[model samples]
Target chain A: AQSVTQPDIHITVSEGASLELRCNYSYGATPYLFWYVQSPGQGLQLLLKYFSGDTLVQGIKGFEAEFKRSQSSFNLRKPSVHWSDAAEYFCAVAANSGYALNFGKGTSLLVTP
Target chain B: DVKVTQSSRYLVKRTREKVFLECVQDMDHENMFWYRQDPGLGLRLIYFSYDVKMKEKGDIPEGYSVSREKKERFSLILESASTNQTSMYLCASRRQGTTNEKLFFGSGTQLSVL
Candidate 1:
């Protein structure tokens, strides 16, 4: 079974600062990784996903994640944070068949001015 | 833009009541999924339908069931609502054969069982 682990439960960053959220997964084969963001009272939206080729994948709202197979880690990062970037972030992993997405507990991001 | 819409944004149901949560996708996707979101447990998949009238149990499917009579609509039913079932329920749809493709999600239905 594929499982995802997000180390950070909550993170606080000031506007214009760089941010990184850690994610690690346990899968047998090459896994499909995804990042999702959920604002208050909203559903999860895809940020970006890594399927095969690219080690680094870019997502919406200037967010990106790198897939490191050796370390079993796919961490989400943003060069600069904005006030509107405050939301809950989840890292999910699916098998090769994409049966169902296994999600992390999610990291709640708090952007402060 | 493609979208998934849930019938209710918030619902209040009493214990032992049968609760129905409806989800419809405009993109005509073949796969629809229902998930419940709790504070620390994350999103746990309850059920999914790969095609019309075909359903499958997800990781957590004990108390919930699903119906997909039409191509674009999927509904989740709670046989007997319990306080533990009171949480945010999310509906998602994805295109067929594209497992890596992004899933479109509805705003979600927040159900409260008292």
Candidate 2:
């Protein structure tokens, strides 16, 4: 079975400040990791994903995440956040070659201008 | 670009009524999925179809059923609408054998049961 854990339930950051959201996973084999963002009344949008190769992956909207195999973590980071960055973010994981993803409870980000 | 569209953006249904949520994808993807999003539960998969007329139950499929009569369409059915079933339902699609492929999602349908 695959599972994803996001420790932070909520995070607040000032606009133009750096931000980091933590995520961890439990899977038997090499996992396929993903980050998704959801705005109010909107469906989830893929932020970034990690399958193989590079340990760091860049996503849309100036977001990026580092995949650390030893830590079992794939944390999302942004150099600077904007007011529009406020939304619910989810970290998901799936087993190698498996299509279904197990998602974390989610972390709600509040950006203050 | 992959375009996934849902039938309704907002819906209101009475308790005990059967509700159907429709989803269509233009990418001709072989895999389609239905999930419900709650306040703190993130997204829980309700059902998925990998081919026409083939359905698979996901983690939470107790009160929901699915139909896929065509490759481009997938429908989610709530046997009987209930207050507890009110949620934001999301539909997603992905191509088969593309294990690393990202899912494309619809805007979502917010269903309210009265």
Candidate 3:
């Protein structure tokens, strides 16, 4: 079965500091990887996605993710963290022909000023 | 812009009552999905519709059913609402084609079964 794993349950980062959220996936073949962020009481918004080429994909809100095939990972990174960046982040994977996405447990990021 | 709209932002109901959650999309997407969001569990798929009148069970679909009578409308129904059914229900839509496309989500409906 395909699965996504977000190791960190909660992470605290100071504002203006760099941040990295780790994600690992288990799939049979090359998968469609995605990172989604959700604010309090709001639906999820797509952060970035990795499908075919370009291991490094930049998404909205100045976020980027690197898809590492060998490690089966797609980690999200930000050079500078803002106070508004505090939210729940989820890593998801879908098979090439699959319709539904398999999401991880999610990581809650808390930004301190 | 693609807009997926959920009927309600918040709802409260009594246990054993029948519940209905409606979703509509303006993008004319062929795929619509329902998911329940919880604190630690993340987002769990409840049901998805590929086309009109075509519904498929997702990861967690036991207490829910779906109806897609039109291309832009997808309705999620709970036969008998229970306290455990209280959750944040999200509606999403995506165009048909490859799996690489991102899904457009609604603001979500927070349902409380008391």
How do the candidates rank by TM-score, highest first? 1, 3, 2
Q: Which ten residues in a row have the lowest lDDT in candidate 2 chain B?
A: B94-103
Q: What share of the true interface contacts does each candidate keep?
A: 0.62, 0.55, 0.64
Clashes of 1: 0
Candidate 3's residue-wise lDDT over A44-95, tens digit each? 8889999899899999999999999899999999999999999999999988
User: What TM-score does chain A reach in every model?
Assistant: 0.97, 0.97, 0.97
Q: Residue B32: error of model 2 in Å? A: 0.3
The alpha-carbon deviation from the true structure for residue B88 of candidate 1, after best TM-score superposition, in angstroms, is 0.6
Candidate 2 C-alpha error for residue A83, in Å: 1.8
| Sliding window of 10 residues with minimal summed lDDT for model 3 chain A | A94-103
Per-residue accuracy of model 2 over B1-114 as CA lDDT, tens digit each: 679999899999999999999999999889899989888898888998878998989999998899999999999999998899999999998888776778889999999999
Sort candidate 3 into its docking category: medium
Provide the clash count, candidate 3. Answer: 0
Off by over 4 Å in 3: none
Query: What is the alpha-carbon lDDT for the whole of candidate 1?
Result: 0.92
In model 2, what is the error at residue A92, expressed in angstroms? 1.2
Give per-residue CA lDDT, model 2, range A1-113, as digits (tens).
78999999999999999999999999766799999998876668889999999999999999999999889999999999999999999999878664777789999999998
